[model samples]
Target: MRITLERSNLLKSLNHVHRVVERRNTIPILSNVLLKAEGNDLEMKATDLDLEITEKTASMVEQAGATTVPAHLLYEIVRKLADGAEVSLATATDGQTISVASGKSKFSLQCLPQEDFPDLTAGSFSHAFKLKASDLKMLIDRTQFAISTEETRYYLNGIYFHAMAEGKALKLRAVATDGHRLARAEIDAPSGCENMPGVIIPRKTVGELQKLLDDPEVIVAVEVSDAKIRFTIGSVVITSKLIDGTFPDYQRVIPANNDREMRIDCADFTKAVDRVSTVSSERGRAVKLSLAEGQLTLTVNNPDSGSATDELAVGYDSEPMDIGFNAKYLLDITGQLTGDEAVFLFADAGSPTLVRDTDSENALYVLMPMRV
Candidate 1:
């Protein structure tokens, strides 16, 4: 292919598509990105077998053709070119190498036949819908951190998305869990999402989708089937395979009645936990919470190191009790809360505790207690 485009335009498209290519590939063609120049645009595509990304940008086409070249190599070359500079790409007569030029810099990249690039076939989609970027971002940001990393529970390695009928309205819900903790978020379902089948989106695809949703005002078109999901955002498109397994029923773990309540300043409680955990052992970073009539004390005791304690006044009038929790897990849930005040509901020291944000009604978190 022979094409010339502004360096800024090429770099922007490369940055979006090259991330899908793996650094090491058992198949030689999987390491390259397919580039096609036709009419007034150049289309670039990259894939890692499970996920694929494509983007298109305006360019000047001298000779219409297609070829494949190392994805990271080409991205790096374009990124280093001078700003506002023009880049030219042309294939040799033997079709074995492609020449790249911009300003006084020039380089040659090995090329593979474009026909060798594999295609991820997206069959007929059962459901299609449009969601505002802001709504989609909120659902993902709240639940992504709780997704399980263990491979044995393959189903829990993704976010489960489904539409449920709540009273008179249909709500689109997202849930994620790692056995020890759970996060759930929801929003009003869009018009086209009625009766859509539940799907588990892989963690890698969720991460890429989050990055692409930087523009809150943009509308994203999503199409999904039992096996694959596709998202179209502006000039970029991402298609990925869904995890093939059954996610356990998460509702069973959420506590129905936890009467003991404690309300505290989110910022103050987070700082206290961090301070007391300094003396905790590396293997068990547990911070014990001692709740009294109107005060709370955070303490950490380690036989090898030392003991630390921090106190804070809380809005708790429940019976006195002590509970232990992992300091890191506590911080993670608090970080996602948008409200100034956090409410925690406890049944006892042995049962799960439910946490909620005073400002947000659509998101909730459940954290399991740890032995101190």
Candidate 2:
């Protein structure tokens, strides 16, 4: 393939697809990116068996052809080139080496046959819908942090995406949990999405999708089937296989009868938890929250290190109660809040506590308490 592309444009496209190529691959072709030049655009594709990303960019095509080259090497070469420099890529007649030249620098990279690259087929999608980039990004950012990293309970390793009817209105929801904490976020369901099948979007796919949603003005096309899901934004397409596990009924885990209520500044609560947890042991960084009328105190005690305590004025009128929770978990849930204050509903020191942003009715968090 012979094509000339500006350094900035080429680097942007490379940065999008090269991340899908793994550094070490059992199959040599899997480590390379497939490049095709035709018409006025150059197409780049990279995959790691389970996930695939393809992107196209406008370029000057001198001779239309296709070849495969090391993804990381090409990315690095183009990245180090001077801004606005023109990069030319041409394959030798033997089709085994590709010459890359820019400015006064030139290098030849070994190439693999394009036919050796495996194609990730996304079967027919049963449901397709469009979502605003900002909405999709908010759903993921709110719940992805709670996805389980544990390999055994594979079902919790992704966000459960589905559509549910809330009264007469339908809502699209994403829920994630790691047994200790759970996060749920929902948005008004877009047209034609009410019948979409529930799917567990793997963690990696969620991360890659977030990158594509950086442009708030972009609208993403989402397609889903029983075994796979695809997302297309502008000229970029990402296809990923859904996890083959059933997500637990998350609705049952959210407590609906929690009585004790407390409202406090989200930022203040986060900072207090962070400071008190400094003296906590690494293994169990638990902070105790003592709530009483008009006052809340956070304290952490560690046998190996020391103890810390902090107090904050909050709006709590219920009877005095003390609850222990992981400091990190509290910070994570509170960090996602976009509003100034957070409301907490407590059942008891032994039961799960429900947390929510006072200004947002579409997102909720549940944290199981730990014994202090």
Candidate 1 residue 248 Cα shift, in angstroms, is 0.8
Tens digits of per-residue lDDT, candidate 2, 269-332, equal 8888988998888799899999989999999999998899999999999999999999999999
Q: Compared with the true structure, what per-residue lDDT tens digits does model 1 show for residues 1-372? A: 799999999999999999888899999999999999999999999999899999899999999999999999999999999999999999998899999999899999999999999998557888999999999999999999999999989999999999989999999999999998999999999988898889999999998899889999999998989999999999999999999988889898899899999999999999989888888888989999999999999999999999999999999999999999989889989989999999999999999999999999999999999987
Top model by TM-score, which number? 2
Q: lDDT score, residue 164, model 1?
A: 87
- Please identify model 2 stretches exceeding 4 Å from their true place: none
Q: Estimate each model's TM-score.
A: 0.98, 0.99
Q: RMSD of each candidate?
A: 1.1, 0.9
Query: In model 2, what lDDT does residue 131 have?
Result: 89
